[model samples]
Target: MEAPAYQRIAATFRGRIATGVLRPGDQLPTEHDLADQFGVARQTVRAGLGVLVGEGLIVARRPRGYFVREREHMVYRPQEKSRPRPAVPEMDRFSEQIAATGRTPSYSIEVALIEAGADLAERLRLDPSATVVARRRVRYINGEPTNINDSHFPIDLVRDSEIMLPAYLARGTDRVLAELGYAQHRAIDEIFVRMPTPDEVHRLGLGPGTPVAVHFDTGYTESGRPVQCAVNVLPGDRHRIVFERHWS
Candidate 1:
């Protein structure tokens, strides 16, 4: 059986983009023009464009036609029941893990501050208005924006530590915490799916119709004190998150 016309059109455009014939920010021809060029109907062109939009390969402007957008690839691995925990020595190691799964890992940190917020205070069991260190980062996989993570930790615990220092910002919190004598013994993760916020759509370069995966993780020290609280938003189409379970 032959593939559908729209799928073929989509594949053609995708190949062009992948081969650099259509670079990021390059404007695509009008739908009518594409229809004429491909000897297809306007709807076929629209369908092709929709595929590109869903793949984060193009963006449509109100007056302008579609333009090439950044693309990313991501994978989620289930924790192995036999191993219990993978030997991830540092946060950078996670990026390496993502790369090993055949996706590129890139990230940018936006905000890292010591401030007091209702959520952080409650999570850390601190008095209302007590200060904590907040860090926000956007992680990219294979050059595509995939997740926005906002994390908070008690300031008193990390103020003078290497984790708060700019030089160690890229090292990730897990390693720094371990060095500071508060190694994480366990983590609880809660995940849900929802539509992306308007701000998230723009900042994460998502299509208007794309939904996001929300992941909440709380890390605890062996003594049971909460060490960190993180909220991560992942683009739905680009990530495949998995969780493994075991019965003892």
Candidate 2:
């Protein structure tokens, strides 16, 4: 079957972008010109361009033309969290990694006492209605929002601790847990791929058709008690998760 005109137009631009002919920030032809080239109406040109916009390949600038999107992706290794922190000043793994790449890392954190939802309750081994300390953070690189990391802990475990405070933890929450006598000895990481929710779109400034990976990291104390559960939401186009294994 013949592809639609809009699809052909979209494909032409997609190919150019993929092949580097349309580099990031390079402007697309004006809608009128695109319409003339495609022998279609302006609305058809818009439809075609909208496909690229939704795919995170291009963006529209009001009073200007559409341009290829520019993005800086970070490689994420879930296994690194288990490794010892480098001998350096107080900084979380996220901060350390981004800083190593010569990019500034920052975060917005909010702490609250909230009831454990079903998923969190199961992970934390608490009743669904039980209170938990929720430490919500939106991580950024070079001032652009990157991902969301919200950690939940049993209120009793973190009560009166720094984790309950709405502030940056230079040493990270894991260290705070160690100080609280609940040092984690093991953790399980689960990742799920799906489309972003409306709220996620707003928070991450995601374009249409952008998907995300929801990561659940549950940490267990030395005695095998669940102490903390962190949910990290990573934008698919902005991150690459890596894992390593050694068969002993």
Candidate 3:
């Protein structure tokens, strides 16, 4: 079947942007001009352009035409999960990464003891409704809220420890876990792409077209017992997951 005129128009512009023919902040032709080119009405041109807008590929500036969006991403490497950190360093891994990249990092954290619902219970190998300690943080970079990192541990595992504190841990929580004889031996990474919930949209300050990437990082002890499960919610426009490998 033949596709609609709006879809073809969107594809034409999408190809141009992907190939770098149209760079960021470059303006698209006027709607009248695009209508004349596509042999369609102005409304049809608007519809085609709207598709790109919703995809976060372009922005519409009133009085002016639409332009390609200026996109920037925070590089996230999954390998950092099992990577080691300083013995008694200044900040957590996220803080270190952002500062290393020459950006200021900060966080607002809170700790709560909650019943491990299905989502967390299954990952931590605990019964549903089991008590657990939840450490939640809204991580910010250069003063902008960037992502959400919430770590969960069985209550019995982290009770009366620094992990139950809400202050910044220069030694980091992982080290505290190690002191408790639950050092992480392995980890699993799970990624999910979906639309943002209302609370997430409010907290992340997301725009109308924004989606999110939910990264579930679960860590286990050498004895094969689950020790930690961290839920990291990253905005689609704000992060890029990266991996590097070499052939031996």
Look at candidate 2 and give me any clashing residue pairs.
Answer: none
Tell me model 1's lDDT, rounded to 2 decimals. 0.75
**Which has the higher lDDT value, candidate number 2 or candidate number 3?**
2
- RMSD (Å) of each candidate, 1 decimal: 7.5, 1.8, 2.6
lDDT of each: 0.75, 0.91, 0.90
Error of 2 at 140 (Å): 1.8
Ranking by TM-score: 2, 3, 1
- 24-102 in candidate 2: lDDT tens per residue? 8899999999899889999999999999888878888888989898766689898888888755547888898899999
lDDT of 2: 0.91
Model 1 agreement with the true structure over 27-71: per-residue lDDT tens digits: 888998989998999999999889878776788886878988744
TM-score of each: 0.64, 0.92, 0.86
In model 3, residue pairs whose N, Cα or C atoms come closer than 3 Å (at least 3 residues apart or on different chains), thus clashing, are none
Model 3 lDDT tens row, 1-248: 97899999999999999999999989999999999999999999999999999988888889988999886888988887567766667777788888998999999999999999999989998999799999999999888899999999999999999999999887778888999999989998999999999999988888768899999999989999999999999998889998777999
Which pairs of residues clash in candidate 1, taking residues 3 or more apart in a chain or in different chains? 72-144
Worst 10 residues of 1 by lDDT: 77-86
Q: How close to the true structure is residue 200 of candidate 1, measured as C-alpha lDDT?
A: 94
- Stretches > 4 Å off in candidate 1: 1-73, 77-91, 101-103, 114-116, 167-171
